[model samples]
Target chain A: MSEAVEIPSGTLTVTRPIGVQFSWRKAIPWLLTGPLLLFMLAFYAVPVVAMLLRSVNDPTWTLAHFHALASDTVFFKVFSNTLYTAFTVTIGALLFGYPLALALVRTPRWAPVILIMILLPFWTSVLVRSYAWMVLMGRHGLINEALLALGTIERPFRILNTPLATQIAMIHILLPYMVLPIANALRQIDPSLPRASSGLGATPWGTFRQITLPLSMSGVAAGMLLVFVLALGFYITPAMLGGPREITLSMLIDLQVDQLNWAYAATLSAVLLATTLAIIGVFYRLPGVSNAFRMGAR
Target chain B: MRRFPSSKHFSRRTAMGLIGAGLAAPYVRPSYAQGAWPEQTSIPDILKGSGELRIATFGGTMQETQVKAYFEPFEKISGIKVRYFPGTSAPKVKAMVETGNVEWDVAQLSRGSIMNLQKQGEYFEKIDYSLIDDGVGKEFRFEYGIEMLVWAQVLAYRTDAFKGAVPKGWADFWDTAKFPGDRALLGTTGGGWPELEFALMAAGVPADKIYPIDIDKAFASYDKIKKSVVKWWDTGAIPIQLLTDREVSMTSVWNGRMAALQAAGVPADISWGQGLSKRDAWGIPKGAKNAANAMKFVAYSTMAIPQARVAWGIPYGSVNIKSNEFIPEARQAVLPSAPAIKSQLVNYDYDWWIENREAVIGRFNKWLLG
Candidate 1:
């Protein structure tokens, strides 16, 4: 059915469908997303809510686990350790990734080869990569043997089972996450802008600083957010390469779960989730990050 | 190039023989192609059942050994089919029991782990003592489970690193001045419980009096040697690797792991002195669908023949005392159960660990960070 409606503008009239056919177009997006939303609600949302509820709901509804965590020195220490490691690894990845991403996007002839080198190791399992790190960084490992042969130092330098090893391996593992996004952003930059700046008598460094760098801020922000969040929850790499004192919050959660301390583990997990959400919230508040997300939505 | 045989050359008699061999293959496929598996132990008719028995085990080469040792033959001897699920842990068992969805009929775990969950709630079935073979030692039998595999946590050291010197116990392990090398110990990072027993022994506490462990004192001892430990290994392989790489001159290693290290001719040796002997038990979850089959399988696997097969396959010791007769003397010399080695190992008290683990682990994390 069709109907004619008079507009507020004097005598203007419009014809419109007045039946079920008119509303169906508006429902298409929902219809497409309905199954996925339900699946996520059932598998992801429900479990997470249940897990959070478990922190206070198990054994007669109490927040003793969280309260205990507040006074627990180990919890504080491990939590701080996790944050510090994540921060350091993120910064390291950004420093290494930006140059690599620039190289990836700038060098047209070698882009595929460079991308392959970055992704080949990324395809390997984290566990296998961590073990490779262990082998390479060990006291008598290849690096040390070469150094010793060169007479760089009389004693083999201890690198494995140290915080340094953990940071190095984590940065290596997380490099691709930081690189791909920045490369995409860099490629999206209008080539004419930098060329125009140069055409206007601007120096190459000046053009890069004012035009190229500022435009790729969104990419840099996105990469940092990704690498930082992933590093925060790292378990295997740290456990394999870190020393005794390098215990992270994830390792602590694992220990509690193994001990059957469900409530306590739930509390620790909730805290980790909260911390991650808070960090992302802060990132979203930043201009560059929000702009990047808005662009991503488009 | 060589020409291949043609199907046209096949005769009627040859075809019939091929069919006969093909039909017999499933039955005659050797379960023990490497050597003779100890003769199959007899089982009661009641123990023979027709159903699937899902067994959960710690995966890897260990599961490979179990397949040859008992899984295949047990399925053949009893009417029950054994299905293996690897990556079994006590925590997983607890979660299954709690969810009322027990995936495994039986799981291989430590007595302490089973008892820890049992103490929390009803998680395990009361093991059928009558179904278990007589060859199993009385000590291995428990109310909720029966120990089928015995292993030890021992002090392993590089024989060449110490200039022909030997580390006898934890005290020597602690003495960096005497041994003069880096060390590694078991850490909780890898799902391993803290090595408090070793810590106490390092503090000069007698092995016999180690029960009801003094946690504060143990940490106090750990403080002294914390800097010396280059690594706090979680997996059994980590210690072996460290020792082989000379990353640590001495480390706490599993007895079973040491056999392979020795076989590889890594100049490393294990000292049984003050080592803690640990056992792995077959625990049936309370609501298992195939509990009957699980009971039967447990009984069959712990018998002399099957137990010997496991010992032959790996360096781990057998709970069935009678299995010793079937194992060669050369092999027995390295087993944790051999009298010479067994006498030196301190019997680990699972009950004590079960009661104190939560508190001790909390303290351990703090102490480790400190």
Candidate 2:
């Protein structure tokens, strides 16, 4: 330093050799990213782009389909109904799922058996499960028959082909999706934190509200996000169980496809995709949400 | 950053191109060979020889029994083997036709599909009038296909529930107060069209005047009965089960299904009065791989003897005049093609329905959703 040695101008500048050395490390990262990039470009991006193009650009590049979607009362009604149903089901699943998940986490010894019970219905085909619910909720179904035997009602209850039936079936089908994640999140939380909080003159309820819940928020959010996204695309359960008045966007899409109106179907699909993305975007913005969700091994 | 040479991309592209080429290679065969169309005489030759002839149908016990009774004997006599593929829906038929890799030579199609396809152009080979028995041909004639079986969509009721006060006809079916409790109807859009048409007729729209049905009026009538309709069954089995289990007091069920329920001692009875009878027909695809064999299969399936055998096993009344001779007089009353039942039954105007099917179904779905 004291000598103030004369430095070569080229040495001060980043040389080609240094650049090459730096790029060599970057090469492996690019190589690793290449397959994923190509996959996303081909499968995900291309299809989504094609769908969007089809929705607005008809044979002559007209927005007739989108206009139809906007102008039509049926479209708006069904779209709204689909969202309303998804939201309600998500809320219902969360309300019911959280308690069950909490219970499962606290359950000692027989937890695996309890977990199996939760997963049992998931093993069956959705179509079969829907049909099973149809029979169970039918006019002269088990519930009605039992009620009649008990002289609770004079007539058979008409529960089949109703929104109530649709919701019940959907909740039963989607409960596992919510439970597994929340349970996993709860199970991973250190018991010592809650114990330490309680030792500091905090009530069990307060400790749960402040510590356990905060820690479990990641799992809860993840489960909610998963269940809500999945609920948006539900077709079979609603179709089989729900009445005509309870028709969803999926049903409308199905009808359009069946009638060979692919353009309209594409439009509906695009709307569903957009709505789902918007939901995910909103979810990502919630405080502590990103970090809370970051804990789990997805 | 250094740009890497995309050898991986090139390899992938090359691999995809090779696969595409391999997939397209089989389709390079000449569209129409000089000897491709089986000579008209091959039908008789195939009938005489011993080989398997595949017959496709909308499969059920009824169709299965018919296949056994009709195709099995034909196989034994002609030494032709028989295979069955259940033709489930119109889309399935379209798929089979467009693919040109037909698994089933002869397929049974609903009258509506037959009319639609016929209007679309010659999907099936035109029948040889000379080969057909005049009496049999006259009875079971269609422009593009031959009638295979006839079944009535009749009012079925639980005898125990209805007692002696059974709903007689379409008018009675619409009357929920008199014949109360829950009702079941078909959930299919196709099924709804015929029901709405029948409802209009029951509301006193005449048979000949049934064309250009008032959609609003039909839906108004449907709305009245909609509340009483506890369930809309999608499959053939559900209506029968609903009646058998006493889940619903009444339902519109196919005659064969009702017969099956009655046979099972479910205390269910069907009314043929003013019943809408659907005629199922046999036809070959437009560019069928085995057109000659398909024709032979169709001809054999529609024959009077086979038709009679089919009628005897299944409740589907045969279109062939000779089938009546095989059926006992007491049992004939239950048959859709019987003189008494046929006299009261409304022969659906297939031409009008076919032309207006899409429009009518669209309106029906809108009404259903509303």
Candidate 3:
């Protein structure tokens, strides 16, 4: 090494070769990513852009479809109902999922068995699951049979075509999606921090509230976003279990498509897409949410 | 280092060129192409070698039995393979026809659906009248399609609910107090529109001058019975299920389905009086890959013997006059297109209904959503 002579005030000497730098290797990674970028552009981006164009243009730059949707009270009611249903289901999933995930993390030996139970419904088709719910909820179905046997009621209640039935089916379907992500996040947290807190005379609940909960906030946020977005787009369960009055945006889209009103369908789809994006944006902006999303990846 | 600017410019130019090509490629490729339909080809030569002639039909036990009865004998006699596809719909038919990669050599379609396809043009091949018998041709003639099966949409009521006070006409059906229980109707506005119109006529609108139907009046009539309707069924099976399960007191069901349900010991009865009978026809798609074989299959399917066999197996009536000769008089009475059943049946205005289907269905859906 050459000794540095201080001639100028703030001059530095470079010794490394330019070829062995970050910029050079960056090109290699980009080349590897090219196929995925192209795939996303072609399949995902193009179709979405096309759908947007279809929604607005529809052979001419007309707001007719949007006007129809906005003017119709049914549209607004359905839209609100979809959001409210999603909110309730997401909260339900989080409440049920967080405890189960904690139990899963605490008991390592029984984890696999419990996980299989959680994942079994996910493996089955949604249609089959909805039909199963139908059998359970129908007038002369299993639930009614049991209730009548217990002398609960003289006549079977109309439970099959109700919003409560829709909620039950949706929560059952979306629970695993929430639990799996949260459990993974909870598992990754360093055990010593909570242990350190407890060792310092912090009570068990106190340590959990101060350290565990804050750390697990990332997972909770992630699970909520996942479950919420999925719930917004659910079509089959609501249609099968819920009454005509419980039709969602997706069911409306189906109605439009079935009626051969493709333009109207496109418009409704765009609305759903916009709503999902807005929710995602809100999720991203929440305190420490972005950091949480990035934490486990690296 | 000195050549960097020139190389950069070259790279930029190449990138711009690639972007331009990528943007323009899809537009450059023509998506719509038209060619001669039913490519004139030898029928026997193409089908002679192929082991199976793939046939597509709506799936169910009835369709399955019909396929077995009709196609199996043909397969044995002609040494052709028979492939069956169930639950095919109009959109699937349109896609297959438009793409010109039709897997179905022959298909069954409702009269309204065939007319809808014909309106699109270039989706179906013109029927070759020469293949049909003259008597059958004169009796069940259509321009673009050959009639296969006929069925009536009639009132199927629970005997337990009616207690011998059965509904005779649309006015009686609308009389909720007299026939009080949950009623069921087909979900589609177009499908059940004619029956509803007939009901309106039975309520007092004259049949001969029932054109330009007052939709508002029709809905007003429907509203009286709407509250009593428990569900609107989308499939044939649903109405049968409704009647058999006693979920609804009464529903309009296909005559054949009602027969099948009755045979299965379901406490349901059908009234052929003032029933709306419709025909399902067979047609070859335009630009069909195997036109000759399709025609041969069409001819084979429409023959009296096969039609009678299909009727015997499925309980649906056939359009063939010869099929009437084959069935016993007792069984013939139940057949919707039989001379006796046909006399009592009201002919649906296929032309008017086909023309107004889109408009009627659109308004109906909006009303339903409301």
Q: How good is the docking of model 3, by CAPRI class?
A: incorrect
All candidates' TM-scores?
0.92, 0.79, 0.77
Docking model 1 quality class:
acceptable
**Candidate 1 residue spans exceeding 4 A from truth:** A1-22, A290-298, B1-35
Question: How does candidate 3 fare on TM-score?
Answer: 0.77
lDDT of 1 by residue, A1-298 (tens): 7787877786887787765664777989999999999999999999889978989998878988888989999999999999999999999999999999999989999999999999998887665576688779989998899899999989999899899999999999999989987887888788899999999999999998999899888889888998898888887677668876888887777778778888998999999999989888887776676655444422
Using TM-score as the measure, which candidate wins?
A: 1
Best by DockQ: 1
Candidate 3 local lDDT, residue A3: 45
lDDT of 2 at B275: 76
Name the runs in model 3 displaced over 4 angstroms: A1-88, A193-214, A287-298, B1-54, B75-84, B96-105, B135-140, B161-176, B189-195, B198-212, B240-246, B255-266, B271-274, B328-334
Number of backbone-clashing residue pairs for each candidate, in the order shown? 0, 5, 5
lDDT of 1 at A228: 90
The residue pairs in collision within model 1 are: none
Candidate 2 segments exceeding 4 Å error: A1-62, A148-156, A277-298, B1-56, B71-82, B95-104, B117-140, B187-194, B329-331
Look at candidate 3 and give me any clashing residue pairs. B51-B81, B52-B81, B53-B81, B58-B87, B59-B87
